[model samples]
Target: MARPRAPNRRATSCRCSWTICIEPDQGTRVKQRPGGMPPHPSQVLARRGLVTSLTWLALVAAPTVAQAQFGDPGGEGTAATDTGQIGAAALSTPRYMGADHNRLRALPYLSYRWANGWFVDGINGVGYGGSPTPGLQMGVHVGVSPDREESDDPALRGMGNVNRGAELGGFAHQRLGSWLGGKLSLRSHLRYGSGEDRQGGQAELGLGWGTRLGERSLMNLGLAANWANQGYMQTYFGVTRAQSTSSGYTEHKTDGGLRDLRLSLVVIQLFSPTTVGLLMVSQTYWQGDAADSPLVQEKRNTMAVAALMYRF
Candidate 1:
């Protein structure tokens, strides 16, 4: 004969054996448990509620996240644990795409990811992404397209502003293998929006190599080329007869093709398990119709950024 098992109290009871509460000055405190038993169901629920409330509070008070103009630095890896980060960045870049001068600005950064392949990021936008296989990730997102202001450069005295608008896009990243002790990957992106008629489309393909520098430091190098459709080329690089007369420039017609090439280097340092710092430098070269436009005061552009982030 076998001995009978004890009745399960947890399945029958909703009463908590212990209680936990947060104090403003002392943080979380737990009441004594009578028998050193596991936390009751109500206690577990209360803990979850407290965590949710704190996370929401942090998001509301934190600064906005940084937007990466080059490419997302960590998009090629495997699925990540649920986490969130907030920070700020100092950025220096051309006022406009073809401007010869640079402008400095301060930007905020925030991002959050879930364990089930969902993320809301300043760089990648709000989207669901996952690795169907090891080393490959694909996803789609909706984001805002950048706008150009005529007042940003003296050369654009007559050119009107290109208003910002929404864009729909998709991205794919694939880790190829190792090269020179670094991880090599390829990435591609395509999006449509933002033009005089809001039909401009663009695509980019790039290669990236990343390596660890030390116990808490990493570095990445990237090179990419961009292609544009007729709508995009014409809106940014073409001039009409009426506008040519007003701006004292020749009326130029543009056809879609290769637009520009970019090269970038980024370094990241982990200050602690919960804190990080980043530095990046990049250069861009305009070609084809984009370079031929009279609006292009300079065909080469440089940009730099420094940022600090806190993870939770």
Candidate 2:
């Protein structure tokens, strides 16, 4: 009886005395801080990050704008102070020709950017084909790039005796777009070498793409279509006396199913003015006619050079 009486008293107290704060009444308003002030640390950090990001964006954009105006020849406006709206070159060709495949060589080149979108290059190779023929070669190359500055990479000239015999001609290059290019050149090796005995030549045309591999190299690939030229084809796939006549030390000859291919790799190492190292390779495949003479079934060539560059 006593326990039941206490319970009854506690229940009555719970129903009357329970007190938990509920949400404010509907439409009730909240109070202001009395005075606006700076936000918390998180808010401040977010604002600072936004400001920092904007600053970095501006810094990145500034160089692009500058390059557009004064530096990139492939770009527009011709803001170069040297050109003064006339649009001139920054400097002459930094590289010259020397003998890599033969005993002596003479490679002459002339390149110009016309007012029109097209660019022009003239090339000539003079020498006795391995013999000292005093031969002549002349050819021309033309193409359009976004601008001339885009073609400034020196590694594009792979290893080859561009002019073989007494021929007259030049090499040609054209930029089809930002990522594609093409070239053609023709020559006649009428006579080359100390004997001055042989006579022939080939016409050449090539298409290629400029692309990046990984983050370390710039690459170029020329297609089989370019070698369709008879002259160019022969210059690459043809067998020379050097190949036909065995030195006894090494015998080499060529076979059938002629082919010529070139690939180049360039690496840019950033230092003071930035350093560039290049590797260029040329390969030729010949089929048939390989008898007694060590004909070249395959010919592979490689060149490596490192150069320091600065642009003003």
Predicted candidate 1 versus true structure: per-residue lDDT over 141-204, tens digit per residue: 7766767777877887788778877877777766576688776767777878857888888888
Model 2 spans with C-alpha error above 4 angstroms: 1-166, 178-198, 212-217, 224-259, 263-276, 287-293, 297-312
- All candidates: TM-score: 0.75, 0.31
Q: Model 2, 1-312: lDDT tens per residue?
A: 522321111222222211111011110011111233322211111110111111111111221110010001211111112111111112111121111231212222232332222332222122111101111112232121111111222321221233323333233223243422211211111111211222222223444443444222334443321122333323333335553342222423333222333333323222221122222222222223311222232233233323332222
What lDDT score goes with residue 226 in model 2? 18
All candidates: CA RMSD (Å): 12.5, 27.4
Question: Which candidate wins on lDDT?
Answer: 1
- Residue 101 local lDDT, model 2: 37
The lDDT values for all models are: 0.61, 0.23
The top-ranked prediction according to TM-score is 1
